[model samples]
Target chain A: MTALAPPRLPTILPLGLARGALELRRFFRSRETVVFTFALPTVLLVLLGSVFGDHAEAQGVTSSQVLAAGMIAAGIMSTTFVSLGTDIAGDRDDGTLKRLRGTPMPAAAYFIGKVVLVAVTTVAQIVVMLTVAVAMFDLSLPDTAGDWLTFAWVFALGVVGCSLLGIAISSLARTARSASAVTQLPYLALQFISGVFVNPITALPTGLVVTASFFPVKWMAQGFRSVFLPDSMAAYEPAGTWELDRVALVLGAWCVIGLVLCLTTFRWRRGQDG
Target chain B: MTDAAISVRGLRKRYRGSRRPAVDGVDLDVARGEVVALLGPNGAGKTTTVEILEGHRDRDDGEVAVLGTDPADGGRTWRARIGVVTQSATDLLELTPAEAVRHFARYYPDPRDPDEVLELVGLADAPRAVVKLSGGQRRRLDVALGIVGRPELLFLDEPTTGFDPQARRDFWRLVRALAAEGTTILLTTHYLEEAEVLADRLTVITDGVVVAEGSPATLAGRQSRPALVGWLEDGRPRTEATATPSALVAALGQHFGGEVPGLSVRRPSLEDVYLELLSAAAPEPALATAGGAR
Candidate 1:
């Protein structure tokens, strides 16, 4: 027998990135999935903003600009929560998870791959939303480095939290066919009460605003508005100021919660053996 | 036992809410560099046994040491030493065979070159997405991925289910080449011919237990089974079963005073031996009547 050296298992990070690259390639190849998933936020921005933009402008900010900012947050959630939930469910149904279980790749690497896939798709959503806002809605890019820094942190927390959440809920779907309903319903409901769908955060009932306050969607919307809308709109917020610190706290806490749920609920197999 | 690449003792698993254990008590071992074929009827615990050995499922009771490590707690290093090809692996959709193989190649420390692995599996030039490949091509792709890590032991579960005649023969050659390289293989297959062609020994399982285990030629005393002797006499056919067919044939030749007219002799084939074993080992009268699934 030839003396064979023990083969090395790749470290988590590079393997994770490689998995991430593969995920991105697969995600884009299904052209309809890309078009439909990406089109939702952009279409909402144009149609909703056009109908609501004209005189809804208050304190030097048009409704389109306000709506566009919040859409970036909603758009990120769409890509992270809904897209990932469906993607993971699809992976389970199509036997991706089973095959990966046999490989030397770690479970954390698989999560990292999903995160990477979400990060890329989320960035694409942000870019599309930003371009539309600039070209059509008269929304300007943040001028100061500090303002841009807020965008970065908010983007980071939002993506990580929602991606983790998507991973957690993906287990609830028994089949990929049902994943759409399992993912879409919760986030769709959150957007409405979180003030992404409904205009003027205070127009909703006090109880509804309080309920939305406990979730990440409201905080994410609040953070994005702080970046994209003028400073004066903070006065129009229910709290009469952008609670950026609380926004960071709530989103960060969700990231931890999401990770915990993922650790507890993920499954590699969906069917009976033998 | 020390030299065994895979060893199991009293392995048993019962699925929740099921009346019977899927694997009642399976004791199997594959020595280093040996090709062992597991043969059984459907729902006969063949998959259950292999899955337990692969560490893909938990056994209710038993001992399993795959590559000398308890599969239940086998770490990443242990996983790197083994290759598993299961029937349920249907992922890797958009990438071409080349792309998929190259990507999987990254996870191993000393994986075979992606191009060479692809070529060995006869998919070196498959340019379309994996989702577009035929069933046979996909099975070959599965083999390519299974061997990419240069694993010391390979567990193949129904690897040739969708393979055509040519593809099956080609795959048999591949298995032989891998065996010659000293890779211990424990393969589950329904094809008796496949077992005869590739396995050093054959194990026949039924209803979650092994009924017989031996080299292909001697399994269930196949070589010792009575052989049939036949000849034409006065334009009428005559036949008889004899433990010593050669002596019987020679006597018949003497009776004919020259080559006995249209004489023939035949021994029980592997399939006949296997069927007899299954019937003998059947736990119920109904199952014995049901016969072997093949």
Candidate 2:
């Protein structure tokens, strides 16, 4: 082989939250992607709340409040996992990722942008759902600042976990159409099992509760339950325990697992074997 | 050292479960400031070779060096040095042209000004909303992003596939300007006219191997091939093939004793040479017929 010329070194761009913000701005501008990201969760929250109006009072809880928290979690999952996954797959399908691979941008920067986009949208969606729930279902705000902090950390971790999982799944989808279908399946299943529609604590089997605990969905829902459900309601649990600390640890574990999977499996372009 | 910008030797790639290699025993050296076009029909492994060079895919065997590093092992630092325009639209739909360019500009160590790149690609006015732009405009944006980094080398994979005549000409001008500025470019196109107009040298690949390599005028000795001398004979069009068109014209000059009306000499075109080469290597005569028809 002949002597090859040296690569023209690129100036490393600053990678931080501010750059993440810039990427979020770009993501929000796409009406279709945004609608898919936030719309389904919002609509589900409203529709479920209206149908279950006053029924929750009989159970000594508010339907809107439960639905609101669930929708917040669901919205984060959709934006970070499903939407991002499908978008990445679409980019690879169209050779967009292939083009970017030749650029100076570090691969980490790309994921950081995605993380920021997902985080921003999660916050927005949570706020909107909470505001709507407060006005329509007489929902109460968190009792203390610690509760609010717990909510924020759990939401953030959940977003990270979902985003990485989405990236991992994107490696499996060869085309955009198939990615859409594959990504949506998990969210639908998780919603029902983790009390997005009904209280999984009462409606689900003990085996499922154990299985859900191993995943991030149960922990995320339990985090929300800590904020909204009364302390006395702990009696309904199989262990009669409020596992906020355990929820945090589980979600953190999920984030780590997701990161490892994404790092190992993600491809900028579709490989022939895949 | 001749300042070789890209170097490859015994490069080989094979898709999984496939017996045939996508790129087989290919060796190439592109010097700094040289414009080398890779010409090949569909599925001729041009894309696989380019992808390996771009560092987007892993090579199964052999040594391949792009800009002094093996692309398969080059990390993010190596990636920042070159530009790539794939045969596809931009992934970003929401980003405006200005925003997209500026965003990508951040990645390069010595990037060109975003505004200048857009202007050079003739997309200065249409800087906002990539989704709103026309196909030609979008392609220009792709080019703008590719050059925003002020790369030493650029890879253009069928850059003008969807361009109109005017847009294609404009792109050619931009390519010429980039080459004049000492940027080594590798372009792959099915358009022989594009190679004729832009490339200083070209390599035609067939069946994962180079069939010919030279200046367009010299490849297959197209310039020296038999020319078709056509003219009006007794109110009817007639043509004759001869290795020496001047000699044939002189003979006709005596027969007519004056200017031969509607007389012209046409050499074998780049397409003709390309087709002949494809025909000889075609899997079947029927396939060759459809290939040339396309």
**Candidate 1: segments with Cα more than 4 A from true spot:** A1-7, A271-274, B228-265, B283-294
Write candidate 2's Cα lDDT for B124-191 as tens digits: 88856788898888888888888988888999999999789998999899999999999999999999
iRMSD values, candidates in order: 1.7, 3.3
Against the true structure, whose DockQ is highest?
Answer: 1
* Range of the 10 consecutive residues with the lowest summed lDDT in candidate 1 chain B: B285-294
* lDDT tens digits by residue: candidate 1, A56-89: 5587788888888888989999999999999899
Candidate 1: lDDT of B131? 93
Q: For model 2, which pairs clash?
A: A10-B109, A11-B108, A11-B109, A104-B80
On TM-score, the leading prediction is 1
True contacts kept of each: 0.72, 0.71
Give candidate 2 misplaced runs (Cα > 4 Å).
Answer: A1-13, A16-19, A56-60, A271-274, B232-238, B253-262, B281-294
